[model samples]
Target: MPKQDNLSGYNNTGSDTSVFFLSGIPGLEAMHLWISIPFSSVFTVALLGNCTLLYVIKTEPALHKPMYYFLTMLAVINLVLSATTVPKSLSIFWFNFREISFTACLVQMFFLHTFSSMESCVLVAMAFDRYVAICNPLRYVTILTNSVIAKIGLAALARAVLLTAPVLFLLRRLPFCQSHVIAHCYCEHMAVVKLACASTSLNNIYGIFITLFIGGLDLTLISLSYVRILRTVFSLASKEEQLKAFSTCFSHFCAILMTYTPMVLTTIIHRFGHQVAPHVHILMANFYFLLPPMMNPIVYGVKTKEIRDRVLLLSHGKNF
Candidate 1:
């Protein structure tokens, strides 16, 4: 059995605390089981879908290109993000096991934020791949070689680690002299920080800066890359060629919208939706984290002919 933390000792001071209580969904105690049904379904789909994506990409030699390599990284990050949050959420919803130790919460916060940041970086890398393919087809192979792709993956990992380290350090220094009941499904940065007794202005400022710097910058670059890609696509002479180029980007565009739109919405609600119902906040947070993982594989499976063909072949019991 997994080790469980005891929360009986925690009080208003939180000085000698060992555990934090995760309130699954505030004021929805009677319907916790009902809520678990949908959450469980989504988590199951996310796990199977992302695992299938990774397996197909690994087995198919045709997927060894730079675009699919970046996709593999995206799948890994999605798996990590879902795995980090969903199991604990289900435990809370179904079994009423919500006492998470302080150390465990910090660890969860680190991986959750790190994987989220890495996903953003992976999307930017995908955008760059598409930009090169559309704008400079001749140099696509030369520019995004295996070496370059590996470097981009490493850089994404490094960025996540370096940027999130300070947040963890600051959290460690704070004296959490308050109720340790986290009123959400998972351990989020702001949610956890808000439980601290001391002023969190610096933490808030740094958090905002990182959000804008990493996520904002990545989104801006992706937009700019697509702008350039659009310019290049429009310059093509044949209508069929233009459609072909744009079709290749349709899946990625859908993915970007799904991943970022909910994120932006959730951030806005977290910062400004003080009057919003607790369940509304929790639902949006769940959507922001869960929807992308569950949807990305379906998007790619439908949009990409190669992956679609492979999936069909595997389902029919032929060699993939």
Candidate 2:
């Protein structure tokens, strides 16, 4: 297996394996150690904060509503998202070993995008939960019962798995006889697809399909939910009451902002910002991956009164 077809400079890696080398942040290898500072810090915070959020939501009966249940789904997604990429990235950053088996790379890409889609789905669910809570407060419980929440979760899992399955299948059929050096920290879908020697028109089409499925479909639905929510909030007679109603949605709005802003911005830059530095694009793309998981718990912990109080009690070593 002459795996060094396109990677001439990396002759030290030899030329007889089915592995890919993860190039940690193009044009920023020297700064990997310094870069690890923020990555390590954010990854650590993502783990602790999401774990705490899960613990608080599970143990505190008051925090078990539809909003919090949707939040629990988000927390679990964050844990998986960060766990999938961060440790592998840290290995590249700290140990400088990037030999991921071909199968492992595909698995990494699978989990990364699958959970990313689920994150988007969970966000849409949260937005709908808020819409019902504000728009139909009288029937909120009746509408989003425990069984409905479980069904929503199952639907999210099904959608994610089904939508992402084709991308992996498409990639497996391509011949990766080109350079196996995957630029960027993770084996992102398009990044791996680009390594194929064969024409990737099908893989490209699948990439666009999943991107539209996630970025297009999810955003439209979330937007629709929030628009309805805003209409409901503004219909209130008192300004104070309107503000109070909207406040309940503040944390979810923050989650949406963190989750989508960087991704949308980076996608734009990638499509149009040809003059921009490569590292800048990679940093922006990676930002969307880590920021949401790390900030979700913090935003919810501060904005939601119930989660905040419980988190505080736990911080102080007091009984919940």
The top-ranked prediction according to TM-score is: 1
Please give each candidate's TM-score.
0.95, 0.94
User: Candidate 2 on 259-307: residue-level lDDT in tens?
Assistant: 8898788877876798988789888888876899899999988898888
State each model's CA lDDT, in order.
0.87, 0.85
The TM-score between candidate 1 and the true structure equals 0.95
How does model 2 score by TM-score? 0.94
Tell me the lDDT of model 1 at 146. 94
> lDDT tens string, model 1, 115-134?
88999999999999999999
